[model samples]
Target chain A: MSVLDRRRGEIGLGDVASALRSLRPADADDVASIAGVLGFGLRAADLNAQPAPTPAIYDHQRPLTPQRPQQTPSHERLPGWAMPPLLPAPEPLPDDVLPSQIFRESPLAGGGEERPAWLGEAYRLLPQERATPLRHALLPARTARGVLVAALATWRTGSEIDVTELTRLLAEQRMPQRLPSLPVATLERGCQLLLDFSDSMVPWWEDLRELAQQAIAVLGDDLVSAYEFAGTPAEAQRWDVERERLVAWRPEAERPILVATDFGIRGTPSLRHGGAEWRAFVARCVSVGAPLLFFVPWSRGYWPSHLGLHPQIVHWHPATSAAMLRRQRGLSRRVAR
Target chain B: MSHYTPRNFTLPADYCFRGDPRDPAESAADPYIFSREAVIAVDVALATGRPLLVAGPPGCGKSRLAETMAAVLRWNFVYQTITSRTRLEQLTVEVDHLRRLNDAHLAARSTSPHALADRDEEYYHPGIFWWAFDAHSARRRGLPESVARPRSEPRFPGVERKPPDEAREGTVLLLDEIDKAEPDLPNDLLEPLDRGSFGLPDGRTLRAQDGAQRLTVITTNRERELPPAFVRRCVTLLLAEPAREALVAIAAVRAPQAEKTLVEKVADRIEALRQELDESGRRPPGTSEFLDAVNTCQQLRIAVDSPDWEETWQQIELVTLRKPMVTEDERSRPA
Candidate 1:
């Protein structure tokens, strides 16, 4: 016989009787079937011989009556063997107990708030050395002499026909003549400059950073705001003009953002989405009537073709020489003014 | 310079020539919304007789501006799409070498004494710019008309026909997507574009007749930076994205059958999606995509704000809004 058969043999008639009593079978056939399954000799009368004890009466005013046993809903009911023992409920805390008390008792009480690993690493990787201050004299003008000449020429001849004047002449009996006048032009405006500190701009990092410092120093308060941009714009603070040091950056926005970078939007994974973001940024600037300029080391090599051309964006490049740098500075000064 | 008047000309039936300078209905059935700056730039370019260099995003009506100008002014239109392989010669004239050789062989074999063999003008096929130049000159001299009507009939059915007249004078040369060509192409165009003339390899000169300056319109997507020298010679215009109201006006003409409410809904959805895509660093859907969605919805007879509208839109958006490569991943994600 197998182990199962030996175990069944070990269970006596008394054990079978106790099991049948606990089951509380309703029918005589059920009682007989339970006894037969357990290999015990039993009749319906044998189960009836020992009935369960009754409960004591507690209330004198009411007649002694047995409470009907609670019935388990069919859907919620589980087999007796499958049901697990219920766990003890947790004790409620006293009203006097404060949250701070609990916190103080915990191991992490003194640990402070947790930060992501990457953010901490980024902070660590931030540049510590102060950039060399670019000389203001070495910086170039904002707009070229040729561009200025062209602007002047356009101003002189590029004007709308005086339609009202023409109509007045026609109404009177005189030949309508073409009369042109220059439109009101804003020569100076406050501008913002963005310095690129992204990984792609590492090659010209020092030069661009120094240029930004130089611009701020020369333009003084005319430069509305200066920012350091990687994936997004962050305002540079703690400006030590003499020492040429920018201590920290916080997120900010200013109009007419002149960015100094390689214009490499394809550098990082985040920049894969940079094209759309950059375009939207530019569109926002345009909507607000702000000029967005891109200052690059080499305009031909660094400029993104995908951005297309924009009148708002004045791409100043190839400022490798002191003369060119001075020209760019002059241009920036003009724009800032 | 005198303003060239179009004689015996009739506007296309589909086009509504309102004659109002403020309204662009004279250009096409749909009115073009030119920004005040763009208008000034165009006027300046016309006055100076310089090529107007328009730089803008792809499909932002850079090329269409030239076509509209041609249609509005009743000038003969000539367009050339530049590619990486486009050569200077292709822009001027294409020499039929094989045909020339065949003509030479035929001339040599001919026994007739009267037969003369010469590198005739027949061997030279004029390019787009050449055609524009020749047409303008032809119109000026009152010579035989070389301009031919488009072979394809009007695409719009049941459109009324307008009265025909004598061929119009002058030509509008549209050099589209010039940035797609080599960087040197723009630089090469400087001399011809400024002088209104270029020389052929066969020692013949092709020059615009006096007082008949061809209106040259050059469009760039900024795929390449144009030479500063080239830029300096031309009047420049930068076309930006239109406002929502402007877009709605544009839609009224482009998709006349689409319901106003439907167009507004589509445009709003497109604008929202564009912003979301831009923020998330994805390629935002363009004006063309929005128009396509509106057209598809109209054709499919999908009613707006119906019980199944949301469900239907979810399906339609897959084909229209989602980029091809990103569609599968976008589908699997929860809406």
Candidate 2:
């Protein structure tokens, strides 16, 4: 017998079934060749038969629910069968797996409730202390001005002449010319201000909060929305520029969001537990296309962790001085615009 | 001479066009897929006669946009790649001090006064902006001057000049990677950019001719913060990272010989890898890396569906995407 014939004869029904399962025939010729190699009389019914679906090692769909492990003989060996050893059953997920549940219990997750007693008492004792009115420092606007004088200058003469130079005959018929107004560059978008009010930021909390309030006031209440993030984000009341008092705000996703944070707390238990919460907030920020701006305190020397090194984050050091913070915030607002 | 209309002109063979539809033979191939916002930004920049300041991540086609626009408009193109030491005067006119010194020495030895006067003009070499402005003038005057003017003289002794026919219709000045220059450069650009003119050291002003305003395209990788006053003068466009479908299309264009499935797989893997890197706080690979990997795969002739393909892909990825010294803190974090 020929080598091809011998090889064809060696092919069994099992081999044909395996080949049919794996091969995706491009055309009728490929299908015929595959069938011919098997040395079997190919029937339409055999080709049409659907292969049994392989059992999944891990059930990812219902992650929390336990699944029964698959049973296969430990030492059963089949010809040409190549598969990895069956994986052990997956472990059950932790009870506090959800971020929302963890966030509710964490002291770092700020609201009026979980904060220090002193902070709450201070707010109650001090009659709604208004933030100081910000003095706007105006920088000189740089303008480019020049005379566009050209040699062999073409001037249309009848009643109109565009001439920078005046000669004898040219001066006689020279008419006053009004150049076309130059186009003004306009900013089409506004920014949303996101403030970080986590527990680690206790020292700079009042100053940063006041800065955020001033930013909102300067940018106009309608143009900006203030957000405070501790364990999760909350819409903070902004100080209205017109009224000169704190006013309520609603979160809007349309404007460009600029997140302000110190990113100081890295190793605290609450922060460690709130990792998922941080990720979710980041994902939401990314989904909404928000740009983060880090407001670092100079003395703390705190660096952002891996979670804080997101591509969207921009860093700014706002030291104790409120003037510097206001300047940086104003610059950021301009840059965003 | 007839006025050159961009709508009617065709891109010539010699020009080395960089991005999308890169194959010269495939004339109908549409390589670039521009977003609606990008198109609108370009339209606005053109309409207002403002320089388009395109800021984006490296290798995301900020510089390529200039070449693409020039090709689309069928205009004359000039590129100035900015570096740290690039002087402000180099943008307009560079006086050859050594040449002037040599010429002065020769004039002092010679008897003719005309030679000394003739050499003064020779010392002042025209820069890229001058070329663009002059080319615009040549077009307006209906002169037989080449659409793209050749440099007056070589920067150094034996450098050969490019062939003349390479010049096309009008001018598009591409100030590529402007952020690489000194902090003051962008601010210095504001005056010339706003006036559409600048004065040479010799007191002669190089201005844009009457009708046409030379299109200026400035690209920045955002390495440093540009002055706000300078940024305010130009129309800005931020090119965000492209979506998966756009990236796949870009990959296919970059490696035309590779199978569609193979290109898609590479693009998907690249996207996933980028995400992984971003999460790990490592600098992620951009479009250039994706292109390099796809090109390498095509050159190696690796079959996408074969068992060996995965191993080959991993090897290629090491060179292209893998950064040395991934942070230990990132690796230890829970998934």
Q: For this target, which candidate reaches the highest TM-score against the unseen true structure?
A: 2
lDDT of 1: 0.52
Best by lDDT: 1
True contacts kept of each: 0.00, 0.00
Worst 10 residues of 1 chain B by lDDT: B152-161
Question: Per-residue lDDT for A1-337 in model 1, tens only?
Answer: 3423312113345645664555444566545544543334442111111011111101112232223123244345322111112234458888796555333454555447676587756455567698877644212443332232121111112233455765677688786344433242221233465666555665665455445444432222333345555544332233322222333432233334566665555434333435775676666665665555666554454455555444233344333343444465457547656
Interface RMSD of 1: 49.1
Q: lDDT of model 1 at residue B301? A: 87
Query: After superposing candidate 2, which stretches have Cα over 4 Å from the reference?
Result: A1-337, B1-30, B109-119, B136-169, B323-335
Weakest 10 consecutive residues, lDDT, candidate 1 chain A? Answer: A48-57
Per-chain TM-score of chain A in candidate 2 equals 0.31
Q: All candidates' TM-scores?
A: 0.45, 0.46
Candidate 2 chain B least-lDDT 10 residues: B1-10
